[model samples]
Target: MWGVFSNFIACEIGFWIVIILGLFTRYVLKKNKLGLFFLALTPVIDLILLIITGVDLYRGATATTAHAIAAVYIGVSIVFGKSMIKWADERFRYYVTKEGPKPIKLYGIEYSKHYLKRWGKHVFSYLIGAGILAGVILLINDSSRTEALLRVLQIWTLALGIDLVISVSYFNWPRKKDD
Candidate 1:
């Protein structure tokens, strides 16, 4: 369990490290090809996490919260990773290299729409993660061993519901633009 948690943390840290390095190489050093190579490594990081979690489960370890979260993390990464990289790229280009326009700060209807789109992504991520959790539970076929994963699924479902409410509320009350 701890191993999963530790590796999850390491994977997260590594993801950011690779992103920063990619941005720096791309914008600061103007090494576009090398930077793209670094950026492309993000999926490999997700694969590593998935493999570790799968291996742990195969070793007869009881499913844990960490294992469940690793699934969620991978799912979220798959859904959001490209956008995150693009987000970083925009900021890096504008702030570091002065090679692009300032990233737009969405407000009003735009902000609400952006929020809703993000919420939709969250919904997709939850579904993917829940599916993985469910698959694991069925594969193990042991209630006692898979109880933690079921709990995670229940809690994540609740969280996603709450997020939906908040996301909808944004459309009702759009954000004000800065003066």
Candidate 2:
């Protein structure tokens, strides 16, 4: 379990390092091909995490919260990774290189709409994570081994519910732009 958690942290740190390096290479060094090569490594990081987690489970390790989180992380990364890179690219171009327009600051209805879109992505991520977790539980076919993963699903479901409420509330009370 601890090994899985450690690997999860390492994967997250590695993902960002690759992203920043990619952006830097693209904008600062002006090497488009190398930058793209770096950016393309993001999926490889996800694959590494998935393989590590799967291997641990296959070795007869009990499914843990860390294992469950690894699944969720992979799902979220797959769904949001492109947008995340784009968002970072825009900011890196604007702030680091002063090459692009300033990133827009969302507020009011736009903010609500953006929040809703992200929440929808969260829904999709949850479905994918839960499906993987369920498949694992069934494959293992041992309630005792998968109890922690089940708890993770229950907790994540509650978190998703809370997120939905907040997302909808943004529409009712749109945020005001800063003075």
Candidate 3:
């Protein structure tokens, strides 16, 4: 049990390190290609951790609650990691570029007359996607009811937090006066 806990902690620590390095290189250093290379490596690391967890299970080690939770967390992270990074990158560039807001195509829509409306739709899409993911996780998870519920809540909270940040940043962004 202690071993499993230690392993989970170590994996999480390593995961964040990879994310920070990738984002910093990609966004801060402007080494887009290299940043992508690092970002793409995250899933491989996740896969390795999953394999370790699986091996322990196969070796007759009874999986504890933490073990199950760790597995679920890694799986979800792998699924959402790239998309999250891309979304953040897009928003970060939008803010830093300081391009005046104007009616423009966003997420395939040809035009949005208002920034709030566009951001609302964007946030709604994220909510729908998160709902689907949570539904899938609930269907697949065989863990304790409490843990599954907690996981779903965590997903919702994270999705909402991210969406809120993006929406707020765009809404509050400085806009040039329309000529």
* Candidate number with greatest TM-score: 2
Q: Model 3 compared with the native: what TM-score? A: 0.50
What is the C-alpha lDDT profile of model 3 across 156-176, one tens digit per residue? Answer: 568667866665565456344
User: What is the C-alpha lDDT profile of model 2 across 1-179, one tens digit per residue?
Assistant: 79999999999999999999999999999999999899999999999999999999999999999999998998899899999999999999999999999999999999999999999999999999989999999999999999999999999999999999999999999999999
RMSD of each: 1.1, 0.9, 8.5
Candidate that beats the other on TM-score, 1 or 3, i.e. the better one? 1
On a 0 to 100 scale, what is the lDDT of residue 135 in model 1?
A: 95
Query: Which wins on lDDT, candidate 1 or candidate 2?
Result: 2
lDDT of each: 0.93, 0.95, 0.60
lDDT of 3: 0.60
Give the least accurate 10-residue stretch of model 1, judged by summed lDDT. Answer: 170-179
**Model 3 clashes, total count:** 0
Question: What would the TM-scores of all predictions be?
Answer: 0.96, 0.97, 0.50
Model 1 clash pairs are: none
